[model samples]
Target: MLVKAFDKNIRQNKTTTINTNFVVIGGGTAGVCAAITAARQGTKTVLIQDRPVLGGNASSEVRLWILGATSHMGNNNRWSREGGVMDEILVENLYRNKEGNAVIFDTVLLEKVLEEENITLLLNTSVYDVKKSSDTKIESVQAFNSQNSTEYVIKSPIFCDASGDGIVAFKAGASFRMGAETKEEFGEQFAPDKSYGELLGHSMYFYSKNTNKPVKYVAPKYALKDITAIPRYKAIGKGDKGCRFWWFEYGGRHDTIHETEEIKYELWKVIYGVWDYIKNSGEFEDVDNMTLEWVGTVPGKRESRRFEGLYMMTQQDIIEQRQFDDAIAFGGWAIDLHPADGVYSELSGCTQWHSKGIYDIPYRSFVSKDIDNLFLAGRIISATHVAFGSTRVMATTGFCAQAVGMAASICVDKNLKPADLLEKGEIKNLQNELNKLGQSIPNVPINKSSNLINEATINASSILNLNQIPYNGDWFSLSISAAQMLPFKANQNYKFKVLVKAEETTTLQVDLRTSIKSKNYAPEVILETQNFNLEKGEQYIEISFSNPVPNNQYGFVTFLSNKHASLKTSNNRYTGVLSVFNGVNKAVSNNGKQTPPDNIGVDTFEFWTPHRRPDGQNIAMDISPAIEAFNADNIGNGFVRPYGTTNAWVANLNDKNPSLKIEWDSEKELSEIKLFLDPDYDHPLESTLMGHPEEVAPFCVRNYTITDLQGTILAKKEGNYQTINTWKFDSKIKTKGIIIEAEHPSVNVPASIFEIICS
Candidate 1:
């Protein structure tokens, strides 16, 4: 790949030619995201793009929406972090475009990457040739421009192919495939059962505007022909509508990336004639003066060279929802098929398949099936004709780019090749890091509604901090708005404390009602009633144990269908997956599959155990003080008194005494903390902190650990702890307070401590 050399006078600060850790080609949706990721990982990264601007189809040329994995199927649904940099784009769009839609989203995309200090983007450059010695690893890439050419001879420990086409992989001798393969190959339903000689053609998209005027009309000769002659084709828009996005057709199949100009030229002439035919016909009398808005010279190429990867995804993967240990990104687009001859037929030609939810894009599909260093992204990633139909969308491609970058970074950091990451011992870190950056390896639809706090319109999938801020839990109003509900049968209830102010408050009332319902499963309108509100102040309140229904059940427990009231096996929408967001657990799955108890509180949107009973004393939950210290206690320490010695709860650190002490050591610095119980949750006395048969334990546990006021430990005893022991902190320092949450023997406890510490 070639990038225009910097001007001779150009000198970036801290002039250091750091060894190139990663080399990413093709600055499209996937490429840019990959570059951003590698740079973010502190790697010396370079972004190579053949185009002048960033963004692939969503650029100034094609102009499409940057969809992320945030749009929910329900009314009160929330978004997730499935959108990495795209989230930043949406937030920027919300912040800048109060009206919401920005005409030139590409400029915004360019600005985002340019502002990042770690990334260096090279536009108006193309990859001409790559150099190699042993024929396995790339030594350096040589890029060129018309006027002058320069070779970036620096060693690239890792290489990523983010080009919309598998150009880099092709150059690096990576295996690849293209066109419709035999149905038996991937066992795709729509596949022709035999490999085809042709594949779908590319498109040059354009937009139009309707002025609602009157113009002399006349029907063209061909417009008079039978519309049903084409396969699955229709001539419905006899009038005017700005519906021209899919009104594209290709001329012939050749070099898509190179022949885009010629294809767009052919599409242009057809556009004028098609418009003339419409205006001349009496059918579109309502839209007389329909004018064209924008046209693209560079067409969005759908079908192109596909590089062979370790895992060539087939239609069966989508239908079966195959789960791989190295899953990375997800795709939700429908399987849209166009002819390779660039013709629109009504019968057996055009086909589409809507994905039930987000399907995982396996990690193997990203790297070459045979080549050592080559990795493919975008439309080039391995997918059967049918599977690619859905996986080739823009939002999905952007995430694929992020995965490519992450894998590249992993190779450089761990000193491994592309195949090694997948075939070698373990690449869990790469998978984990990619996931941390809004990528999914689950290959499942994401439902994060249960985990979000704020009602976001565009920004979806955000992490909810379990950390609570002091509040007077009065009025007791906590709501979860869902676009729809799911049918579930969880016998569990959430345990949380609400701090309420008692005086001047009376008449506690709570109401439950459905906001939306499905078409067939609407609630019976036998009686009419309204919901009631409670007083503004109450001392303490819980998710009512005595009340038959909790307010959250009305919304929290939504049916699969839009119907406000639907039952399981009612032909209702109980099969759609719903993701609830909670900081502790990133994802939970429920298809509204079963009917839950009428008395159960769906308010918490949680699953309960039958033995413990709903709202049971032993139930672990998120609780906070309802009232401020109006009349305080001078006690240095506070503890929750359990009913019996058999009902003990370990001290998960919340606030620590200045007099406590602790210590610990490990091979690597520990950033996160979690406890484990041994005997059983109900019996804390029999618990032990011993590593299982697994190769190694996660953290070093001490019999006692102490932290100063600043939250840093001063000392600790290395030993297995199993009791109601105060996992002490290093008390020698000073800061605020700390909490020592016991791990095992009790799995229900949630203890997370940060900040409050001593230097």
Candidate 2:
């Protein structure tokens, strides 16, 4: 039954005025981080999201998995986790919603924004009008709340355009560019020879489920006829679901923003057509119960209008691994470029080019050169199209948002513009503050002068006594020999050990080399060489140097062309260690047959190791009094990558109850303690995929207790999920020494601590 009510009432339109210190437009991943950072920093912030839900493409409407430095676990990115806010979001999602439910993930984003006291969140609001103080700066923005039909004029001293389309920057008449730049313009080798106005198109994804009973899908009148026209139709499998149809894209040659409606309609047809083919094609087996559960209405857009900033990132900067002094963020995803034709193109889905390692992103790329008060984040940040391919991922964009938000807060405090902050040499101040806030800036350490841990006498339960984790099992020699490198601090005594497995009696030759240049991974200078005759089975050989290692040097151990013997390797690779397979690429096929070169260089494997310990501990090149973990240098040594074992402090296995003790020369008042734990970077944080069994890594301290020297309990927490844990006292307490008892959930690994700070 339908009920109707008749009322004689007159309603008047309302206009509201809101003032804030910072206004962030768009509630996407970047905007969410930007708003939260600003509001948490005590700035009055207003976040205007066009859609009812946040997350933009990552929202339930268009389900694109958030990927960044990890690159969906591709390209040997073992320890590449985006730090700061992105890290928090990923860890929380993994802990709370490990099943990868999209509906639940939406609430995770919503709860975070609502928890910020200083942020005024306006959902279902679209900003269309911009009021500029002059041609050079923006004064305010006018937004319309479609749900309530209310007009809001939001005024702010600073504005960040994370709208993905750069709507505010465009409306403000800021200088920007659309489409690709010519190869000659930026000397980008990856760019097309001829420039085109076409951009990367839009895509729609759908989820399908299996029902107990048979279900049918009816093709709509507008459904695509003759699925044979799509060459990739054969690639779709029966079990595939949402986000798998990333290639189902269209509308690149057309205007993506203005012509979004037409694009959505075309995407709808393609989606239905693909589903019809999958269900009725008769090629799939045992899929009679499969039905389309959900299909996206909105298209996930890829490239659009990009704002021009003080510095434009180019492909060369990414490939060459350029280290910028003003680096505020980092990206390691491959340069993945899709054709302008998108799904219609006959070629493969995309072309990808990889760098040796991660690259740095500068702050200059996020601040506008033409618009003084405007900041750019997300996909719209200043970058050539070739470079944008790598920087466009959600996690990378989130980091950009974090940097912009921090910069905005600084601007509000200093009464300076975005460009003024950079010109006045305040970028270092921004970097220092970011480190303090747990943001990871490559190669930069947190400012140590103010850290109380620096003054304290640091000690731990036990220090690692082995060079590498022990390898007791039999390890056969590969067809080719290999080499491994270990990194150490300057002026340190070091001993190299290797476990040899000889099939028969054989002589093994080894060479030790040093890094030729600073900051380079490859070794060039040979330090020592030795040859030894080994018996069958396993033998432990140790080599000690008479002189202490020089400053900033890497010890490279190479097994020279040993065909009769293979060195025993540990199960996992440790930080500061690199294994090279005979210094040459191997050609092999699935059937274990030598194949022709595929042009891809397979240099090293992540879990392969050449050094071993007799104690069978999973140790990697560890050098420690264990006190370095409490040092301020651990805060941002840029060694967050999991396999890189340099920065973290590991407890010795001898202690039954591992504890870290800090003893001060004099009594000090302590109010708070900050602890950073290892969250298992090897695990990918994605809702669309099945996560690890444990919400928090077993290696992470599941239960921990903090106490004073007199045995008074300070604080205790159990089942912690976050990487960064902070315990604040009700009141400051005077203590000469403190003790931390951390219990590992698993017996296989010891408790690891990344950074510890006392305030």
Candidate that scores best on TM-score: 2
User: Tens-digit lDDT track for model 1 on 1-759?
Assistant: 888776888653331232578877877777777788778777778777777778776676655544433221211222222345543454344334433222445666788778767777777767767767567767766664432344344357777777776666777777666667764565554674223324666665555566666444343443324333333234536432221334456643556667767676666655555555556544555566666556566676777777778878876576445567778765654455665555443333344443333456788888777667777777888877677776776666777777777777778778888778867854566665654444434532222221111111111011112222224111211222111122211232322333433233333322212222211111211112222223444343443222222221222321111112211111110001122211121111222221233421112122211111111111111222211111111011111111011111222223232121222221112232222211111110100111122211111122444433355654444444321222333333232333332222112222211111111
Candidate 2 at 202: error in angstroms? Answer: 1.2
Residue by residue across 167-279, what tens digits does model 2's lDDT show? 99999988888888876788775675333224788999889899999998788989887887787878888888788678888877888889989999998998898889888
lDDT of 1: 0.45
What TM-score does model 2 achieve against the real structure?
0.84
Name the Cα RMSD for model 1: 16.3
Best by lDDT: 2
Instruction: Give residue 168's lDDT in candidate 1 (0 to 100).
Output: 64
Question: Candidate 1, which segments miss by more than 4 Å at Cα?
Answer: 1-19, 68-81, 98-103, 146-155, 193-198, 209-244, 251-261, 278-290, 341-343, 347-350, 443-489, 492-759
